[model samples]
Target: MSAHEDVGELVPEGTFLRPDDSVRRFAGGTVLVGGSPLWLLKLGAQGARVFGRWVNGGEALRRNAGEQRLARRLLDAGLLHPESPRGRFTLADLTLVTPVKDNASGVHRLLEATDELSERIIVDDGSVEPLPEAALRHEKPLGPAAARNAGWQRVRTELIAFVDSDVVPETGWLDAILPLFSDPEVAAVAPRIRSRPGDAPLERYEQDRSALDLGSRPAPVRPMSRVSYVPGAALVVRRSALAELGGFDTRLRFGEDVDLVWRLAASGHTVRYAPESVVWHDPRAGLLEWMRQRFEYGTSAASLSARHPGLLCCAKVSRWSALSWGLLASGRPVTALATAAVTTALFPRALRGRGIPATEALRLAGVGHLGAGRILAEATRRTWWPPALVAALFGGRARAVTSAVLLPCLIESAGKGPSWALLRLLDDLSYGAGVWAGCLKERTIGPLRPQFTDDSLCRGSGRRLPASRSIGSKAGRTCDRSRSSQRYERVGAR
Candidate 1:
């Protein structure tokens, strides 16, 4: 029934919980069953949390028979063995919540792994076609926020692990995570993610760089320190933690995890990074997709900055650069020249201490400028349809006027100061796209069926990640063999 009473019955006493459970406690406070750190009470709290509004975030995944079975099994196990050291756990299912326009190759592997988990789910988040025979539960067409909320509502276990469909877990992934709940205070757990191979070189490089950059950051175990945002790709959260925060903010299109962590920290919860838990992701490939994603990110960042002024300075550069590029892309030679000159003048500030390859960084800067230009061009066209359309289709007087009015100002501003402005701009755009796409039917467009044939994305096709043996052996246990060169042709054979 009630959480406290339910938890009180599980741990009668005298249980040595796993190491992670001991290490993850919130501010060194232990989780108790019958009012002390034990397995039963922990399990009970986990179960109660899974069925309520808190578990709504994971509804889609739990709606599928296969996924639901997994959830049921995990919940059943928790209910039966409330104090067992190995049995205490929760399931946080992650849904990508992106349009079906593109299929990340690693999705199958994620599904494959989910089948093995004690509690597994793949929330479709209103995709064009229900995830290839997986049949994720459908909910109203809401964005990521609602999808996550639905998921949280379906939780039937003590811990909820959110793993994106695009991310494949390494063998023993959960082996490294579940025990952390033994500590009552540890509210959340995040795993390390590496980019899967077989992705485009640029995509791989970006993913690797991001993993390296974010992976090294410290995880906050203290109530006072803000936990680094639990990446949505692979995060394990306690049911109690989810309830405490009241689930993800349905309003945020981007940085929802960051906001969640900020709130959790503000509410005095502990979050830890379990490096032992590994997930592989192959991020989007192609320059256009990358740029689009980044631009959307910039919009979200701007929204965030508007609310949190600390982000304003960082976000300004991207916005300014985008608007400037919009001007230059038009036939505004004078403005382009002035902006270029001003941008060149500001080169010193932009270049300071950045370790990224000079060429690559410059390329990104150029893209940012071009994206801003595109946005401004779109705005202009939307406002004055005929002239803007003509100017867009064929260079015209208005194009020159736009460049003249905006270019000099942009170039001058860029030259005067270097802010992490480009990054902010990209963040805003990516986030904005995510939000905007949520509303448009065209955004959900995907192939009538998977475009890539089995042969196309299989091992010999050069789109596979390295494969390894399962960490432990069990009858009928499956490993995602698609990426293994040895088993390439054998996919679907078993």
Candidate 2:
């Protein structure tokens, strides 16, 4: 397949370079991507000239052999934007399901929010106050996973829409996302779960940084892609796929959504995240409950790690970001500046897989590490961050440290004060603590182990990387970096 075949057109985080940006003149033209080296293009004389023209003229492409080659390379690198294909699928074929417990008001709000659906199933998982008569009541609480399975069994449509009662889906969510199932391999598609209105700082902080909200980027949902697991809160799934997989493992009360998605990918199916499909979720307004919810969400990670091992380890640290933060926290301002050097060097290293080009692999590495790093970072919360925060603040590197840690939070905080950012730190600590708790309960450190492809094992075995990255480019056919590559580790049972 060509580079454009599976590339999503919308890259929310603007590439390191774009059609419009201030050009910095130097001895040679150089453009860094995500602060890494120019993986978008080789930045040779010809490529640099083409990029300069596009940058100055606000053009994403030019029609010519050399320019087209560079453009395809850029597209493969996720720098050039492709046209996002419009989805076309009938809503009538979809069924909406949400598992609820003591969320009558949330359920009511959802009723109004997703009025477009004709068949909506609200499986009442033993609500305390007793849900309204309109709900499909289950006498006993079977947990969210089981509750979802109960509802899906009744669906006759090709697709099922699962929305958490706590969230209110914005208009056009179904329209924007349901079409994703047009691809037979796609088992499910999840929307962007935005934070609902909250009166307190913690709630406000979650608005910009809700644990459920994957940033606004549309990508295939896989074990470690832009979206690993779509939250159980909301999803549009193909009915037959769920049935074939025995629905969700009804035994899992928590992280069932994760289990389902990972299972789908594991079984050679596709899942996706559509940021345009917005679902506003009302996160906990109180601190105690908020922390508890985070803790609960974390317990699910240990469970997921056992089921999906390689995805949750520190080795999945896809980006060089935490490294910079580490140096800053160590009171080594002089060293933090070298982060760019460290990151640029690793840019080519993530490219070592058989079929994936260096540039595309780097992007995928960012996504994989991002998904993996969250788990790894949370695991470290118990031992790091707190002391690092103190040392940075008191050790006279507050300005640099703050920028490194909370710069991204600033956008999500939506102008909330430092308390919001502080709460984020506490949130990680809470989740990290939960991982330890889960490990204790499970009686294994399997939750903390890292797994990656050792090409040496595959070489003599004549095995290949998973089907996802199995497609090789002509030029990349000879590209071999298993010795140097760290990302694009093969998936499936060891």
Candidate 3:
């Protein structure tokens, strides 16, 4: 079939719509049959405000390129403003721009994220199924990057927020972090990730660790050079700034988030973590699934280290050392025997007390250990980020520690799966580990230093500060004059 033939459907008849902001006419001819609704929007180059539709369908294309359905209509419409004053973007929530796919639970979670975003658009990433009550916006199989670009181009808002398909935004997320953009120098902000409740123990543990890394607690403030990459699960980026950075690196299979952050930093733009902007992700439910995730993460890390050879080589060495240490520490006959016996006895407690059936708890523990090993293998394959290796090698150990700490709390949460207990342990251990590791690294290189002393995080605050400057604050913020004052713009033909 011709590429354009894959345009599954067209806009609905007499679609009820409104014309606000940059749009002059709600044209019906711009849509295709069997595709999603198409609202051809217009955004003036300057002085814009928010403009978009809460669209649904099998995904809609901005413009057709005959046989090339994936062609970028938005990018082709405008020239890059390379010299535009680049700033970071901050999103209050995830913007899921894909066709509705099966996996009911997954879709429900996506819907949760959609509710979180101040604005959201579902591009219908070309679904074969009939459109739901929510029409698809675009139907062509534009790769995510192309769709994202097209979506941004259609955005009348000053910023673009991106969220993954499987993530669910937490409550009070947007209101907590939306004001951080007052600085304008802050171009982007990524959210903290937690585990979805009702999943298996291992999944819960994985999410706990992820959330602790980016939560509201005081994190170590190292030189900007010391900061690592951000995850894209829930990232808000400035539209103009991302356009300047060339949007998402479509070429990457993984590390796209890292690549984007690295490029933003290199360009002298600031990328911050909005701890209050939180999303809970559903981690792989079983041990084998977790292993698959670790392998992919390892492969991505290896490739990343190879590219940044100087900075990453130490991480590689650290990985090997940590692995050897883990095996030596845990695989000792005495230790292994003790762990086996303890683990065996604990199975009953886990079943009765932790709400996990005895069979499932034991099964998950075994898988969790195996998954940790896979993460270790991933670390060894990488050249740097040795701590991550340690995390992998001993992740099961951490899980064991976390679970031990959680048993009481699980019993206390009254069958809540010890999520709170797990979170507390992770907060103390995982985040504490990052802070300690960063500090140790600094001690070797020198004292931990600030990347931008003039920025709010480091300047004269006697008390520990939150990671985000404006998240969760109740008062209106004083706008900084050194940056742009543009608001969300309307995008359509006026």
Candidate 4:
């Protein structure tokens, strides 16, 4: 029997389909399951069909020896996993928790949307008006983090779900997300929050693309990856797990979700973003509301940086790339070019432990810098134009840069309106402003400071630390991913 060979196990009943994000088919009969965990397959028609069958929920075929062997290959390739028994848990196993301030209509909407559960608890966080019949009132307005703690405390269920009052979970949301906890190490899972469409442009802007919406990608919620934070808007958490960690931080007024997820990751507990299990959220359509929300979000950066000193920077991106981005943003095309050259020239020092030749690494770094330069320029146009403007006026460099920026906008936007690049710029600026504000308030440049990761980071002990402890480590010191955060209570993030 192979590593995945388990005769007693049943196929995963929940959301277990093979994600199609990185499956590539070529002119030859070769396929690659390429992303994160990567694999290559030189498949004949029969092999291809076999792979498709498993992806499409063909568990019955597992009885056959040939099919089981093929399945083992798939599992080893990081293409699929055997479904854990759904009998392990159900909708009734998790308790529902909703925290509210004064949104009676929002609470009503949430109550209506949630499905069958053994227990549903609502924490009324300092609501001025009389409480709704369904709510569990708390006289004082504890922030969301504290409110969540209050709700989680009353229930003794195995799992506790925290849903923001404004969110309405779609049908099948539980069945789709609950199975993720089959891995006992998984602390929590959050569903994607889709924006509810509004009458106005900003509202419509949010509907198509909300700041909270993290898109359809199943990713480990870690420090610097694509899916970093799982929003507290809709979460299904293992009660024992949160209980051991002391629940949500009462100090966090905003970004409690980020703080919780990051803490879990650092402590070696797994957190996943399940985009398939979705909820509709009422977005801030008004400009003032949006601005206020983003600014508040920004202020949390200083706090998070202070808490997790070494974890806030880009984990995998090279410094050359970061410098190129900044230089391009400031309109210094020459300086940006020189910076990339210098970084490449010092490849021995700049690109150590990267496993690639210096020249090859330099080329890769250059290409990445060029791409980021365009993005930074667009993002900075609204903030400030730099000395590069004078150079752009003179030569073909201006035309070349303009074409590079506009060409991508036209192609990627695909009629989505106002180019995604421009939209991204606006988004970054909003968050950047808040970061600046927070820095000003704290009288620190921590947010702007870079915290680079060393590939060779280790624990105080001479032995090499496990991979989990490394990615999960703060200050690049080896620590158990699932160990208690109590020892480092201040190293929390949002």
RMSD of each: 22.0, 9.3, 22.2, 10.0
Deviation in Å, model 4, residue 263 alpha carbon: 1.0
Candidate 1 per-residue lDDT over residues 13-119, each given as its tens digit: 22222222211121112111111011111112222333221133332222223223222222222211111235355334322222221244455656566665545
User: Between candidates 1 and 4, which one is better according to TM-score?
Assistant: 4
Taken over the whole model, the C-alpha lDDT of each candidate is 0.43, 0.59, 0.41, 0.60
How do the predictions measure up, each by TM-score?
Answer: 0.44, 0.66, 0.44, 0.68
| Best-to-worst ranking by TM-score | 4, 2, 1, 3
**What TM-score does structure 4 among the candidates reach?**
0.68
The CA-based lDDT of model 3 is what? 0.41
Compute the lDDT of residue 439 as modeled in candidate 1: 25
lDDT of candidate 4?
Answer: 0.60
Off by over 4 Å in 2: 1-88, 314-379, 382-415, 450-494
Q: Which ten residues in a row have the lowest lDDT in candidate 2?
A: 470-479
- Candidate 4 minimal-lDDT segment of 10 residues: 485-494
Candidate achieving higher lDDT, 2 or 3:
2
